[model samples]
Target: MHWSDRYVGQDYVADEADCAVLACSVAREVLGLDIQLPGERRPGPFGRGALIQQHQADFARRVDEPADAQPVLLIARGRAQHIGVMCRLVGEWWVLHADEGAGSVLRQRLREMARQGYQVEGYYQWL
Candidate 1:
């Protein structure tokens, strides 16, 4: 079974299933890759930022336009605070994330998120 399939409808927990955890969960479950993230094991946005920066070579930064199903990291208020898997369903690009606000894993339109002021710091392809 696909790892993503396991997370559909799953709820989000701040320190347990937050953005970073969700992203890493996908990596471990789907790709069989284990990434060690820093910051007391429950790192926040800044910690995630450091993790991305440290492993920059393992990712190809997205610079052009956004695409579907790409792993992305988002920034809010100039801090890297969110991460998710990009997905396209029903002809719309959505972010599959463990939303803190919604308190669950949900899919939100990429455009709408951007309109709400969340900046796509960058998207990355695992290498």
Candidate 2:
């Protein structure tokens, strides 16, 4: 199955299918790696420290340049809270993620999100 098949139409549940979970799930599927997220099922921030720690241990290395199908983490309020897979649709860079505001999985143009003040904290490749 393709990575996008995991939860393409799934609605975003606070702890269930949030941005991080969606990203991690796709990464797991595409890269065939094991990623264990915290058991807490809350909608708020997943704590920057914990996220950084997990990424350090699991992801291969920090990527300065993101390519299509790469996993990326987004920062909000100085905390890493959102994540998605980088993709190109219609010759523009987009991110496929479980958007809480949208209440479902959707693809948004990366540049548009940045213009709207979304901070891309880091990008990493699955190990």
Candidate 3:
């Protein structure tokens, strides 16, 4: 089945599941790859959890297309640790992600994950 079908009614948080889910959906749609599981649960390449590393790699290797074609970089964060998609670029200070709180995707501030103290592990993607 398609990823969209699997995502129906799937709830998420701003910096947690919502970001991860959005990143997964975008990766699948744009990259045609899958990154759901890993050898073992470990921190992401650039972060402290599996999901962040997975999403970052997927975006860099695949989704970092042309400016006009570049898809959003979905991410997972926070205590609840959810995921969301990066929908668009807003100027130079912010990137957009799907916000479950609003029941729709929206753009928000863009901060370096390192500065924010977030980590990554493995991730799933489409490309």
Best by lDDT: 2
Clashing pairs in 1: 12-104, 69-86
Model 3's number of clashes is: 39
The segments of candidate 2 whose C-alpha lies over 4 angstroms from its true place after superposition are 1-9, 40-43, 46-50, 53-57
Question: Whole-model Cα lDDT per candidate?
Answer: 0.69, 0.70, 0.41
lDDT of 3 by residue, 20-52 (tens): 446555566655656453323333333434454
**Whole-model lDDT, candidate 2?**
0.70
Q: Locate the minimum summed-lDDT window of 10 residues in model 2.
A: 40-49
* Candidate 2 residue-wise lDDT, 1-127, digit = tens: 4445556678988776777677777767765667776564443565643655565545556789877667777776667667788875676777788877779987778887776456887777766
Q: Which residues of candidate 3, in runs, are more than 4 Å off?
A: 1-17, 37-80, 85-93, 109-127
Writing each residue's lDDT as its tens digit, candidate 1 over 1-127 gives 4335567678888777777678777766666767555545435667656766666565446546555545787886577667788776676777778877678887777888876557787777654
Task: Return the clash pairs for model 2, or none.
Answer: none
Return the TM-score for each candidate structure: 0.70, 0.74, 0.35
Residue 41's lDDT in candidate 3? 35
